[model samples]
Target: MSFIAIDRVSIQPNRRPLNDQKVAELMQSIKANGLLNPITLDQNFNLVAGLHRLTACKLLGLEQIEYRIIAYQDVDHARLAEIDENLIRNELEALERAELWLERDQILERIGLRAQSGENQYTKKGGESISPPPKTTVQLAQEAGYNKRTYQLGKQIAKNIDPEVKEVIKKTPIAKSHSTLLKIARAGSKEREQAEQAEQKAQEAKHQQKQEEMETQAKLAAEARTKLKEKQLIALQSSTAQKQAKQSIRSARTQVEKKINTTPILPGAELGDEWILGRHLIYCGDTAEDKFIGLLPSNAALAIATLSFEWNHDYLIDEAHIVAVLAREGHIQDFCARHRMPFRFEWVLGELYVGIYSQDPILKPEKPVGIEGVEGIVAYLISLYTKHDNFILTPSLGHAEVLIACERMGRICFAGDKATENVDRAIARWQKWTGQEAKKEKHCYT
Candidate 1:
């Protein structure tokens, strides 16, 4: 072991984020008995392992730290070593493990340590080396203590899920679940493929550092990322698996919360009554009923409603700045004839017909957002019509997408339904997401 100045070690910028708890524990241990195992670094003084120990020493105000320097062929080789260290020593969360697995595969391929499909040690596939034999998925899976199928699925979960979604999920209970992640990754196949193609095109341009092509390449990359985001957004909203996965995550989080907080959280609100959840409000009663209507905030930003035979929410045009109704063209026309509000515009989103009505003529969207499902449509409507802290009114509690979207988007939702079961499910989902108990209002209209 050679002692080196703490400042001499350089760390990769995009390395796995540090776990504060781990660092703290290391600090306590090192403070008592000193660092027993030295960190590993490349010949160039780049960190390979013992990041937590190194960080703890730094936190303890140590100037020099013990390290072991090893030679490697290149950065990829060093990176492979670092990956091996993490995989062997650390108990990584499912998402973290999945990402490391994918990175390892890529690094192995880069260094000719990975075998391509349909090639064996005895066969020459592309004049590639097979002296020590190449590592396949089966081998890597074995190394990671997982079966081939489980490992491949883990890699797919890492590679396929939207990067943004992964970040949001990283700190949640869902990050620990491989099955839920697989379900989300499997949603919206067609859109996901398109997005992957776009991302691949953008990746191909990364190595082309030509000054002339730089500007053009940058634009292409941006466009590609935008398309990928769009596809993810669409899939996230419209896919059944996405909702189910989130529900599962919510359930898991709630259970975890239960263990920590001893005071049992009981329901405070019920059907034909209203209660506040975080900043939003929900009523377990008919939306058109005067009791529910009387509690409404006058300055709602947008109102979203589905097509119904008992449609009488046209007055929403007056209460909200924009009223959007989802129905077919003929149904919309029939409703337009009966409702007094001016039909401002109409747009087709995926398989749904959306009608826009306002007290005044509304400006058309510069670019219309297409939708393939309720989740997508609700997200789009929330984005297009509402701002932070704006009130969004929804008549139906169908899947709680509007409430979920509003909760995530910083909007206050005023939603109600005649079915108490639907209202109860919505409330439960919200409670799980926010980890706060819903209280029933004292006064109930019996």
Candidate 2:
């Protein structure tokens, strides 16, 4: 151990950024107990280890500090020591750790000290160190508290990430994620290789006497490298955007499901009673029954019915201006043949059919309608058929899609379902949406 003047010690520009919190902690500890360990430095008082401790001592206004000197073969050898010291002791970010690991590996390889593959790093635990060399990659990984695969992956991240893309990544949340880094490093593999080859050719050209040609090759190489980096940036942005889109979809679905689950599903909405929800009406029985048909409004602009096993509701054509049945192709065909409704036209939406039926002649739409699943389909039909405060009729309240759509569009929904829970859910949905309670009529249609 030796003492060095605080002013004589020099820090390299490329050293890791000083951690202020760590420096503060060290200051408190050193002031309380004094520095138990000496900082490590090169012969010329260049810092090699204990950066936090050195900083603490400086802040404490210490004139000199205790340190140990290590004689290095050269600047590279000193860098290797510093990297090793940091890697072993500091809690580094993934990018920082990877950079240090790669630098250490390269320095060892350049100095002919890196151990070869299949070479024994240690014959036994606590054995003598290998002479004139370093440990194998597996051993190095183990020393770094990682498996061989993780160590190799870290090196790949350091070596493969484009510099500009790397700079962008450093400020983002994924910078600490090894898996994300690996994915980014793997993208644009072909472009990266091409850029590297171009750069190598340019370097080779520099050895010759053709100055103009060398400059041209160098410019081409630079352009290839730029394109390669741009490709990585685009790839990362696209991946991040896709991930966010999926998350948004998931979040939306989750919210819808949550509402459905939390809503009341009470039974016993009596078979022949009617309830009013603002301007909407809900019946409490099966639509196929004869008594239910008599109660139907004749002035309905459209009736939206879902396909069911009991198929006698075809008489809806006479009651409503237009009727649309949502069913599969086979079911629609079976219904058209079985019951003989108006069947004006059939519209295909993916595997589902919108069987349009009307007593009057119908005109085909000029353009195809965009689909946004079943709920959106119901909403679209409501929009096409009704004016604000006009009535819409649906036989089954299965998901209350029609009811909810009508409520939002300011159209009245005249809807019913036999299932007691279905009536309860519909009522609850309306109540939740409008922030008002529904009214059950005392009159029975029996």
Task: List the global CA lDDT of all models.
Answer: 0.75, 0.75
Candidate that scores best on TM-score: 1
In terms of lDDT, model 2 sits at 0.75
Clashing pairs in 2: none
Q: Cα lDDT for residue 400, model 1?
A: 85
Lowest summed lDDT across 10 adjacent residues in model 1 is found at 256-265
Minimum summed lDDT over a 10-residue window in model 2 is located at: 256-265
Candidate no. 1 TM-score: 0.59
Q: Tens digit of lDDT per residue, candidate 2, span 43-65? A: 77789998889999999999999
TM-score of each: 0.59, 0.52
